[model samples]
Target: MDPAAGLTDVRAASPTTGDDLVTLDGVAKTYTTATGTTQALSPTSLAIRRGEFLSVVGPSGCGKSTLLTMISGLVPPTAGEVRIDGELVDRPYRHCGIAFQTSVLLEWRSVLDNVLLQFEMRGIDPAPHRDKAVALLDSLGLEGSSRLYPRELSGGMKQRVSIARALIHDPSLLLMDEPFSAVDALTRDQLSMDLQQVCMDRGRDLTVLFITHHIEEAVFLGDRVLVMTPRPGRIAEVIDIDLPRPRRLEDAGREKQAAYAAHIRETFSRVGVYRRNQHEGGQA
Candidate 1:
């Protein structure tokens, strides 16, 4: 069967709140690299409902990151348009938060201070969110380390701090590019669970567009998984995760997750697409 045929209209499967929170209509992206012009994303369309955790996966350099940046308004599309909540997106929106493969904490700053950096950058007062930030850290099992510098923390702790920072502003949309890629397997699992809980607790619907190379992780976390093709990428398929909600890592239902993951791997193989750096082992 055609992979595209496998996709169900995401909205049809789940009732959305009013209008879509994010819409990509015939969007495309091109880059003028040293090697010359490169088309990263082909014309594509997608709609993200409010409070949904959506993951995009494809062969590396297939504009996965480009798509993330385009939605975040960090990079302009070469063609077509991007809109958030019916408003055209021409620049980064204040109601957004982002985290990447690395923790990206300021090396000189203490963990608590780094967590507060986002508020300072936006010129927003951190006092109101300070308790929330502290609570986030404590829940992540990093309460005392808040006073320590990023350099003094372990890789997992640093990522925990990064996650805390991203949530400080209460962004309605979170764009994450492999945020847990640097941590160990155990820590990564813990972070995934923690993130789900965080989203559940927050109001105003946290719409997340997460990019990853790990099929299993994508299946495990995303409400819908958008798989993409190779260079000049186009969305290949959108797989709905029908597993029962509130999933934990060690649940017996994990076997079902493995089966869904197998479907992704098989689908990728059928399309002759693979991750850019297999050795990296981390998601995009």
Candidate 2:
């Protein structure tokens, strides 16, 4: 199958502006261990505009996840600063929601309860938000499964629950790190649309920073795609995705999307993630 077949979309976004919601001013990270010092991220600066979907892609061992960590304040930058809504990210930023590749759900909690878990962890009453949780689940196409447990759900279903949980509190920013990597191809496509639909429903109030290895997925979903170089990583390029939104999964076949994907693949080749075998006329 074509690699682009796995692509997906969400909502229509306005062009990005100077109105920044998150800013990284010359931010960098380094670590020193018994093995010695290692630089994880370079002194990079970036501004994430409100309500834009930014997809980041890079070869493994690059600082993709580290970037997310610093932005979320899970770890502080060794140099420079990360500010959210103009405040320093000195600790875990409360107004942000994060989801990883795996759907980290409690096996015991019902689906609706799992979503409400966000409110629970924050020490807030989950009562008023229970209906909202149900609504969220419904919006993601799991309408009546609220009473079910994680064990009863498929991989895709569990991820839907995870996303609902993440967005339940209406966070200004959503950080997803390879959130669809585990699902099957067909399921990945479905989840992509579901994710986009949720973003659309929420409007431009939510900013999404999605990290993935799939170039097609990145091009299909992003307002802008960030290409990162190999470790001690720094931004290689940031490509604007100018496609029409509410994009169908089939849009992956279009010339515009394919062109974007091709450009990203070319970036990967130049960065040595993969190389063409000139003699064999194929990729190495």
Candidate 3:
């Protein structure tokens, strides 16, 4: 099944909001190694409307993670600037929440306490946020596991807890970096569905920047998917997913899903960043 077969290309028009929630102006990054300096990202510009779900996919070492760090203000960009709600992001911004590939839960903390850790870090009273934490856990299907330790949970449960923790603070922007890549395939699928629901439920208020290596995942979850080139990474394409909202994996036939995946795969191939043999036969 050639997924790209019979698919038409669609591009998203830039939104004309009075103020974009997030903006990257000619952002670029360079790293100084012991031997020499290496350029990681080329000058790239982007604007994210409030409450939009944007997925970014690219080959390894393409500065996908670096883009997230700059947006979160955890790391400074070598050039250009990242702004959230029109304010320059020069340090760790309290308006953003982040989750990485690993669950990174505190083994000693109960699930509820783990979710409340964000409050602790912000010097806010956890008491005020306890109900919200419990609600978030319940929403993610972790209702009864609040009292359980991280070690007692399955891989999927731990990731759910991580997500709950990230959302407990009610951040305006959520940055997720390959959050489901470490879980089993079945669990990954389930997590994908759950996260999709979360985005739909909160899409009117929360903006998400999701980074993943899986083309299918990116296509399934993004309103617009941004594809980057290999090393010295820059945006190669920004594909608007024209599918209906509240999408299910089974909603679009394999062909449609394959089409989306195939388009991204083709883009990578054109840049000499992807090889056909890297993926399994008949798998997106």
TM-score of each candidate structure, all chains considered together: 0.88, 0.91, 0.91
lDDT (10s digit) by residue, model 3, range 1-284: 33343322212223436657888888899999999999999877888878888999998999999999999999999999988988999999888789999999999999999999999988988988788888899999898889999999998999999999999888899999999999998898889889999988996689999999988999899988888889998887777787887888875447666688888888787766856574557444
Cα lDDT, all candidates: 0.81, 0.86, 0.86
Q: Candidate 3: lDDT of 209?
A: 95
Candidate 1 local lDDT, 1-284, one digit each (tens): 23335544433433444757988887998889899999999887788888888988888888999999999998889998998988999988778889999988999888888888888888978777777778878987797887899889889888888888887777889999989888998888888888877776773478888899878788878888888878878776788888766876775246778777777776776566854577866555
Compute the lDDT of residue 75 as modeled in candidate 1.
Answer: 89
User: Residue 151 lDDT in model 2?
Assistant: 90
After TM-score superposition, the amount by which residue 253's alpha carbon in candidate 2 deviates from its true location, in angstroms, is 2.4
Worst 10 residues of 3 by lDDT: 5-14
Model 1 TM-score on a 0 to 1 scale: 0.88
The segments of candidate 3 whose C-alpha lies over 4 angstroms from its true place after superposition are 1-19, 275-284
Q: What is the lDDT of residue 59 in candidate 1?
A: 81
Clashing pairs in 2: 10-196
**Tens digits of lDDT, candidate 2, 69-137:** 999999999999998888999999999899999999998899999999899999999999888888889
Candidates 1 and 2, the one with greater TM-score? 2
lDDT of 2 at 84: 88
